[model samples]
Target: MALALAAPLAACGGGSDDSGADQESIGLLLPENKAGRYEAFDRRIISSRLSTLCLECKLEYRNAGARSDIQKRQFEALVNKGVKVIILDPVDAHAARSWVDAAAEKGVQVIAYDRLAEGDVAAYVSYDNEKIGRLQGKGILDALGSRAATADVVMLNGSPTDPNAPSFKKGAHEVLDGKVHKIVYEQDIPGWTEAEARKKMAEAIKDLGAAGFEAVYSANDGMAGGAAEALKSAGLKNVPLGGQDAELPALQRLVSGAQTFTIYKQVRPEAETAAEIAFRLLRGKSIKSLTPETADSKSKTGIPARLFNAQIVTKDNMEDTVIRDGVAPANWICTKELAAACKSLGLN
Candidate 1:
């Protein structure tokens, strides 16, 4: 899907450049390194596509490691360095607004990537975040089947500072609130950190007892891993867990029947789309026609966005979704320990 430019081309520092003599620089600000995919997949994908799309383009990248202040500083540094476009996965959605506005003032185009930063950004590229949550919710309900009516579940959501967390939580609650016997406990994991999720899960298990909850609604794979750690420590087994991102460990857990399902957003397209848009804007070309969808941001309306679809992946369909599609390599997922399971699943 394409996204029309939300802000005017001129407003984004675009100007006539028939000769293409100027060397353009694009800045990528990622939120954290704790999530392996941000650096391993997202950065590589974005940089690779940018290099292919604009051979001469200079790419400057930084990870905030989930620190809002550090991201703020990084944004300032990029703006001061006069990069043509900045693709930002904000550490704090609301806090990133000022940085977006600041970039606007300098005529540097800002493209909100992965997580939407609330401001007048030139473009936004991400999946339908609420849909991701809904899929997770439905995966849990489906895994539980009729047992959902009698099951107790606990929600371990993402960082409260990220705006997407609320939408995710809201979507999950919509499907889970009245359908389950009890929502034993729910808390937003700060920084979306694995350790925090582990601690919260352990606490929840302790208070509610191992038998109290049947499913875990973890927001992403990192937290799912943490919850798994806690569950293992408590001697809990075969608990249905929902996650997103389809990280390696999560996929492995799904194969082992530890994690029920994960939502795969397919980051390659997202990164490529963001890079394509930034390259066009850098070269003084219009992108209004490329972006077909518009989304509402907290401080702005009609933000041009390329929203991708997210898919639900279980052990049964991993081959068709992530592996067969080449999103995750068979060799990477079918490890030594997972050999038997992989062969049983027809992964080899």
Candidate 2:
């Protein structure tokens, strides 16, 4: 279970002593790269913010590649390396209890990032996951319009191991249960794999026929891409599809009418918040100011937490949200094939 570590990011310029005794190390362990946000936004933002916060601090980062065993090993390695604070977005939130407990035994602090990890964590940073789900359900309703009254829907949920997945599903059901005609098919995808999503979506189409479902609710953008491909292969047209994480391709799909909408949880602020908390914790400062709210996991209660809000992104508000915030720049989403869609949306 030994992980191949990436080189630690050393902060540039000097404000504090650069000697080994004066240096501080913080570890960031993210769950997976399939969603792209971890590597694309979270890692960079957290690293930069930490550099700004502590000029002599070193950031050690590791990605589990969606394997809990790998993440467990990485966590152990960081603790062994004397990293006093670790920001962990667990690949399997349930499996994190022992790891977090072991870290605590060694006097290490754990900050649950994005997804809540079980055990005694110093702080938690993430979005209102259930609200994201409600917005996703609303996206489907909005796309369905008049047809929502009798429309059949398919639900493609996220990983069962991810703690946030259930909240997302619960929120979506709250919004869609009585309002929609029926939920014809539902599957909880493991690891949020796009291929698994595609296979399940194809299976649903096979069992229910091409016209069986009127819309699809993918838990995140990565799965939405798979669902889109399956829909296209089945020759299913204009079946409203919604997903979370307004990723670049998802935003492109939104403009092209392939995806109805996506949930954009501003990642920079979330990453920065985690970074700031880690810095404060390293400096022995109280984080009560940063964490105004509280969260509870199965193993622990009343944990200090900071939850950000999410927005539903569609073709109409592309400019106002993701583009304006620079989460996904206009040029990044406005590729050559999507130029017409971009121009029509005034993005070009």
Best-matching candidate per TM-score: 2
- Across residues 226-260, which tens digit of lDDT does each residue of candidate 1 receive? 99999999999999999999888899998887788
How much is 62 displaced in model 1, in angstroms? Answer: 1.6
- How far residue 18's Cα lies from its native spot in candidate 2, in Å, is 18
- Residue 311 error for model 1, in Å? 0.7
Q: Which runs of model 1 end up more than 4 angstroms from their true locations?
A: 1-23
**Residue-wise C-alpha lDDT for candidate 2, range 1-348, written one tens digit per residue:** 001112224572112222232228888898888777777778877887888888878888888888899989888888877789999999988899999998898789999999999998999999989898899999999999999989999999999999999999999999999899999999999989899999999999999998788999999999999999999998888899999889888999998989999998988779899999999999999999999999999999998999999988899999999888777889889999999989999995
True-structure lDDT of candidate 1: 0.84
Model 2: colliding residue pairs: none
lDDT of each: 0.84, 0.88
What TM-score does prediction 2 earn? Answer: 0.94
